[model samples]
Target: MTISANLALAYPEIILAVGALALLVLGAFMPKQTSLVATGGVAVLLAAAVASATQPFGVAFGGGLIADAAATFAKVAIYVASAVAIPLGQPWFERRGVKTFEFPVLILLSALGMGMMASSGDLISLYVGVELSSLALYVLAAMHRDNAKASEAGLKYFVLGALSSGLLLYGASLVYGFAGSTLYADIAKAAGAEANTGLLFGLIFVICGLAFKVSAAPFHMWTPDVYEGAPTPVVAFFAAAPKLAAMMLFARVLADGFTDAVAQWQQVLVALALISVAVGAFGGLVQKNLKRLWAYSSIANIGYAVLGLASGTSEGVQAMLVFMILYMVDVTGFFACLAALSRQGKAMETIDDMAGLVKERRGLALAMTVFSLSALGLPPFSGFWAKYVVFKAAIDAGLWGPAVIGLVGSVVAAFYYLRLIKVMWFDGSAGATDKPPMEAKAIGLTAAVFAFPVVLVAITWLNPLAARAAQALGLA
Candidate 1:
């Protein structure tokens, strides 16, 4: 491809990269321009979304990046999620008497990196994308510098994230050495012809590193703390966009680069899925902190998504894409509800803090209820359909044993969601929470409506779109 054509293929990423730098400069030179910077950041993301939707599909950057249906789908979602997050942080920081334009800029940069990840066509690009996103997240985790827990969260994430990066780089080197190239197409050709022990080892290490990014079990120690300590708005973004980006990158690396070795990687994914489901289901039962509980909830949900990937079929990938999109809505809305509520100027962090929420803030309580039910996979809610398709995909791929275990895990996870709902509606008043911010309330209620009636309509289009994106993975 010509240089101009490659640049055109990367228009969405260019918008984000250039816009972030512009916003950063504007914020530095201009005083008290946080709100303007934030607004600008959202505009940039929306522009990128439009660019992503319109970009033609093709290999670019010497096959180091790809603009395909899957990349377009993921990039648009990542941009929208990041856009929502910018407004969310503005009100949150204002309440605490802290004002900085860096938050939105960092989110923009992170979204830029995530866009790269979704489009990555080679190991080098994958590593670059991962680091770009991770560095911004490390800073964001500790954006509340005055808070000890926030600092601690940032430190832990940085340390563990660095370790994962090391593993990734080492694996990438090994893969390069064994396959004689870093491009996924090259690796796929090499693996298809003859799967070697060295290449498989490298693949295993790479999976471990990506698994950490998704907060799958055994590497999930940082999630609960980070979610509990980071600003709620940041956590909302963390729970939604990055998860989908990492999973799409994961699907691409495996499905596009290692399809011939499905038998090898499928076993590894199966183990991660079952372990994550078990830990997320049982571990959450003992949590008192609401954020920590949701952290576990995210872990289990990722497990289900990973289960779909484990099936190693195009249908499985389609189910995974649909499931992640739906789950992102439910999770983001849940965190937004949390961000909206407070009691006596203190944030609500524990389960007991939500006691009798329906009495004081019926709208928030109702939104929370809808999100909880949808997350629990109850009938008529979006989460139910998400799980149904994932389970169906697994069964169709002849993964009945893992599918059954995943179903049981969902049943076990129900207790925590039900407990949360019960506390909100039935328990005695813990005292009225301050009136929620307009942005948080709007996002929460909108997500709730989507989780129900709108989802019924959404699936009509989402299902076919997801199938097309999955087909782009070339996983027959």
Candidate 2:
């Protein structure tokens, strides 16, 4: 189809691309100010993305590209989260006297890459799409090059990211060599008892590589260092949007490209899921830094999402989508609470620093409590239902052990989260007296953004989310 003919279904990404370029130019002339000034650009782009989301699904370029519901939801998450993360970082950039223009541009580029990956139908296309996103993030993680922690994060992310990309490329080449095509549709068409063993090996390598991006354990060494070292605001971005993109791509690869190989991958996912949950549950217990604890929490959370993926059914994929959405909300809320805890001109990082926080900021403390509970998958709140949906999918698929273990991991995770809560509310620190002079309205706004889905899941019509997931998976 002609590009113009295909335009409406892709309005969100086109707007993002155009906005990235415009910002590159516009920001150079504009003075450095608060992050909220960039709100206009973010809003325009987010609106475009949301607008495209409700469009009809279609194939473009002979299945080399797709425009569909799954891509739409991914774009929605990316735009909305970017809108939040950008403002949160603005104050840092303005204070440092650095150019903030390129920052939004990079996010736009990353979002574009994510949008492409969401719709890619072939391995070559998917790899290119993923690398585009990764390249942007590598620069973003390092943007604050003078900060030792930021530098370290950039270096670590670059080194590990390169390795993962190499592995993924090699696997893609092997898959292409064996199957003579990289398109997921073609791969699905070709699979059967006579499916080439090389294809299977390539598949394993691809999964291993993708796991690193999502920070699933065994391949997760870089996560804590990167999260702790990068600016807390940057870490917030890392934890939120990119994950939704990676998880969506992972789902596409499994459901669309390799549905025939579900049995092979199901075992692999189960193993990763178990290790992630165990390591996350234990590792988080000893973490002193809030970001690191959340990093470990992210690992365990990915495990729960993976458990849903391993179900290898339409319902399974929908549950995974819900998990990603809910996880995004919980993390964003937690980050907002973190940002809100700055006292004496320092953003709080260590758990001990949070003592008497409830005394200082009652509303933020309550928000943190809600977010912590959500992260632990506790009841009545939105996170509980996120876990419930996934666990139910697992049980339905006869994956009883993973489902039951998932429950145990959730309980184990609660221990550390509660530890932080206790510090905020009960274990008052000796000198925890400082508070931000200015309110973090962007932080609160983002927290509200994150909170909506939680309420949506708890109230009427989860079917909308489920239907979106099914459409994204192209179940029709």
Model 2: CA > 4 A from native: 31-37, 96-99, 437-442, 445-459, 471-476
Q: Give TM per candidate.
A: 0.99, 0.94
Q: Candidate 2: lDDT of 364? A: 76
Error of 2 at 276 (Å): 1.0
Model 2 is weakest, by summed lDDT over 10 consecutive residues, at: 433-442
Worst 10 residues of 1 by lDDT: 89-98
Clashes of 1: 0
- Considering only N, C-alpha and C atoms within 3 Å, which residue pairs clash in candidate 2? 70-472
Q: Which residue pairs in model 1 clash with each other? A: none
lDDT of 2 at 454: 40
Question: RMSD, each candidate, Å?
Answer: 0.7, 2.3
